[model samples]
Target: MSSHLQAHAAELAHGFSLCELAEGLGHLDMDGADDVLIMGICDDSRHAKPGYAMLCLPRAEGRASEFAESARELGATAIISVGIPVDTQLPSLHLDSMGQAGTLLRRMFKTEQAGAHLYGITGTDGKTSVTWMLREALSRYQQQPVWSTGTLGLMRSSDDIRDIGNTTPSLLTMHAMLAEACREHVHSVVSEISSHGIAQSRIAGLDFRTAIWTSMGHDHLQDHGGYGPYLAIKAGFVCDCGSHGGNVIANADHADIRERAPASSRWYGHGLSRDDVDMGWEQELPGMLRLRSRGEEVVIEDIPLGDFHAENVACVALILMVSQDIGLQELPELLSGITAPPGRMQDVLAGYGQVFIDYAHTPEALERCLRAARKLARNRLIVAFGCGGERDREKRPQMGEIAVEFADAVWITSDNPRGELPAVIASEIEFGMQKPYRAEVHLQLDRDKAIGEAVAALAEGDILVIAGKGHEAYMEVCGRRMPWSDAEAAEKYLRRKNSGTGLVSEGEDICA
Candidate 1:
């Protein structure tokens, strides 16, 4: 499938003058010639073409004007920047902020999504799973092409999902994707909106027809500055959806979202005892999720996944019910046999106790995955997890605490130690554990050896969960990234153990 909508550069760049673009920012200095006509807007100097207006965004290296010479050489007609003076004679529009300029440019170039309904989901967890399930169910139920973009990148159908770099891409790329979806006549476009994406104004101009709140946690505190700002940014999107007369699906279990969600917003929770909620999962059975709301009940028993997916599946039902007017009773059959996204509670090895792989990088996510794995395990539960380097360090210890609190044994190992030393990162995680539980914790720098240790010790009826690097295909150590797969490693270890092979290979006992 084509990555973007086919639109002539001149056609997409038409109908915007420099003065209107400057005025859109409001109260910005309209330096240079105001009458200069702009055919297109570009943030990167490398993508600048003749008649294109470039945004000189500030960066760590230098001000936006640092790239003005190159942008001018590439036929940029004008420069839009914040506090950067271009050396060229080309007209420049100076703003108080480059983010504001980016927002304005997105608004100018955004295509009209004529027939597509837009759904924006934001949270610390379940954004990817919920969006993926939503797209799958909507496409099958409505019989129209449905598009989704999030942590799994852009997925139009089962065959079209791939990474587009960022969880929520740059505004230019987002608009271009929507334009293509519109041209293909897709029915709905579901996007996973991250806290950073919203904080950076990446989805500035698009009007979402519905928005869903998954769950919030302490992750991304460093990026948003603190938990208060982080929570507010996620809530801001829910508030925006509600005020715009669009449907808002709020998680009734989360107090922050429950209170701020609009009066007309639909809610989903695990319990039916809540009097105020519109929909909820009334019963929890073995390998089944039963939901009830408004005297209507639906039971989905065909799911091969865990209990953690109960809420995500319910969120999909609520979205379809509100946006497509589908009945609650019909949801069970529609979602029958739906599969979880890659690395999300995915069962990689099933014999002699299952080995589940998940992208549970956050404390809340890890806790949920472990608790769900605990329910499935008939005996002991062994968990292997690690913290990513250069991320929110505060959560590292917290995650360590959660792993010990829920699982019978925990294997702490390297998870993309990036620039930080693997041993140093593991030590921080160990800090979160209590003295009594520290005996159960084992630190392994080599991920393959870690999985081998955890998997080899698992007896029949015992479950193993490898967390932190779910769905990822590579490992980042120091500054180099090498091809790696947690699921593949676990399977290989299980195969070797089952064949009566030793857990540790020759010359691979660094953890010994």
Candidate 2:
């Protein structure tokens, strides 16, 4: 086991009694139940072990009571359910609601004393980007280890990440990660709070020192029921931070976010009125960002990306200013070397033309990525993208419309069409294209083939963007996840073309 795991194991060596666990949850009366010893806690029956307390929460698959027997078979000493009485031989604790689960887990794990400044970032887009940017900026500014957890994974640094299966992991897993980070002497933690995580109460008990709202857009509507609920969930995170005496940083460019943001929120954005926001940035030149804050401006040169990223950078700057008391003049050196997280505008090949991979699944994200790609393209800009299965279907045609509007050529391919027909998803996206179809568009269900063809079509000075599934290494089809990557597929085609092994017409000279 790792040192942190060893430390956590040592910490949990003295198990908590049933009475102590109940008391920690503010339940004075344990009724006549025996004071069973609990050494570990888990939500999944598969992870249940001897002396462990299995939390039987309702999952999409089944009810809480259904897993009680399995957990009991795995040697779980007790059962904790949310108002669901389990007919099991093991001792059980019935909670009033699901919200109490996080509290109970945090108490058992002692995560509140994790000794790390916690930062929560929530939004439809740019959450991952801002999380990583803040992680890098803070690490450099503080000269200490700063960790971040998000869609990428549990990252100790940019190059060190351990996949924990979700953007915002389950309450038990989240607390465990935080406790381990504390053991590692990590200075702070930047975490991405997803809408599903919020609705599910995954982050129930942890306290944040600062909460960041990157931007809000139409995403996960099906899960949230509508835009209003989605916006409310994102807004509620920052509002809760403010209520807890934590700092709030929001994007002022978003009107709904601005209106809903807390009164004391430190705002950051682009093109907003000078007096409106606490921090702002503008593209002074190509690959250059000029940040304005507190009547002082600092220009960060060699940005290495598009203008859309300026807002994320500005958000990071504002976070340092608010939380770390870092000065504006220090930002140029602190953040000058910061790079975008993998799969969020990752450049793969740049020889004859350039190929970029991005995780742009939403309409707004797709538009921003395409616009950024368009600016970087000296010649034609081709884009290949698709929507995920069982997600917000409303953005399908919207993304198609955006693709046609910005790209010279569009390839709509499959993106994790889990339990949904890839052809149907592609048709819905195609339905949104302009009537005249100003750009050349094609629907290819095979993602690898689409990427290969798109890469082959790129000429000198041209740019090709492979969107959706940026950093994801697997493609979920039906119920199984198959190993896949857009960056690898693009590079494979690029290598074949460069090595004179790719298919070419008669007498056509290969560019070398």
Candidate 3:
């Protein structure tokens, strides 16, 4: 276990009596189970331990009740079921809905009034970028620890990251992390709130200081059933945060977001003339960005990335300005040292040309990344990416269309074919490519081979983008996660080609 988890476990060592838990959760009638002591709470049976209550909830694949016996054998003291009863001799609490789980867990973990200033960023893309940016800027400005949680995992710093399974962790895990942060004297936390997180009520009962909407796109339709519902879930988060007295920061460039966002939201975007949007930015030179808000303007120099980052930077600036009372003059210095999060346009320098690895799985994100790469490419732009299995299949062809439209070359490869065939996913993506493909496009099922081939083919002044699994260190195949990394594959091929030894040097893992 990591020191972070260890500290969190230790914090819960005092435990809570069954009566206290029931009263905190508003369940006044505990009857005979009032005296049972609960040390921890767990949703997964595999992690259940002595004096812990096992939560048997509904899941996509199966009911958690199927593993109640395992949890019992592992020393679970009680069972908490949501709409489903578990056949166990252990004392249990039955609830009608999952919405109460977060409240109950927060009470169990003693984090109902966590001191950290919680900032939430939600959208299909830019969530990870904005979350990390907030962490960096806030940590620099406050001169204290600032934590963040999202696709990159629960991170206290770049060097301290612990994967809690999903982008938005389970309710039990979320409260536990917050409790840990409080114990560490961390004052701020930025989190990426996914659509699935909102729909599943993972963030329930938590108060956010600010809710940021980055950009809505065509992604996660499979999990939400359709685009409208997916969008509703995103909008619901922003509106809920706003209604609860939290500041709402939205991207004015996205019409859907602009329309659905609360009227009181603070808007930020590029080239917007609306009076409501006080935050806007533009690239004045190759490496300089000028931000304008109200009547003040600040010019940031030596920006290492593309124009797409202008909006992300502007969003970060707006948050600091409104929430932290940070002046515009202070932004240039605080943001000058900020870097993109791992797997977010991370560049690996080669002897010839440039290679970037990004987690651009959505069509909108992929197009933006390719467009940025095009501006830096003097020769040709090549991209290697693949769609994940069992996701929004409609976007596969859309991404294929976008890749060919902006990139001079494309390589379609496997990106975690969990249960579906990689060939089928590639074929679906290829179906959307224009007939008589304008660019040199190849369909390779082997991801490492595809990345190696792309790197080996790079020419001077050329740029290659390896997309889909940015900072991820593992590939999920046949229900097993194997160690893998796109950046590592690209660098290995580049090293071998440059050395002429046909041997690659083992490089240190880059912090994500």
- The prediction achieving the highest TM-score against the true structure is 2
Give me the runs in candidate 3 sitting further than 4 Å from their true place.
1-13, 24-31, 60-75, 86-90, 272-274, 350-353, 500-512
| lDDT for residue 107 in candidate 1, whole number 0-100 | 52
Q: What local lDDT does model 1 show for residue 205?
A: 69
Give a tens-digit lDDT track for model 1, residues 330-355.
88888878778889988887534489
Overall lDDT per candidate, in order of appearance: 0.79, 0.82, 0.82
In candidate 2, which residue pairs get closer than 3 Å at backbone N, Cα or C atoms, i.e. clash? none
By TM-score rank, best first, the candidates go 2, 3, 1
lDDT of 3 by residue, 218-248 (tens): 9989888899999999999999999989999
lDDT per residue, candidate 2, 1-512, as tens digits? 11121111113535888777776453332444556888887777777888888877656235566687888898888887765556667777767666677677677777756678999999999999999888988888779889988887888865677776678877767777877777788989999999988888778778889999998898999999899999999988899999889999999889999899999999987853387888988986656788888788898776558666777888988999999988889899988868888888888864333898999889989899888888889899999998999999999999989988999888888999999999899889988886788788876678888887787788888899999999899999999999999999988988887787874322111111
Q: Give TM per candidate.
A: 0.90, 0.92, 0.91
Lowest summed lDDT window (length 10), candidate 2: 1-10
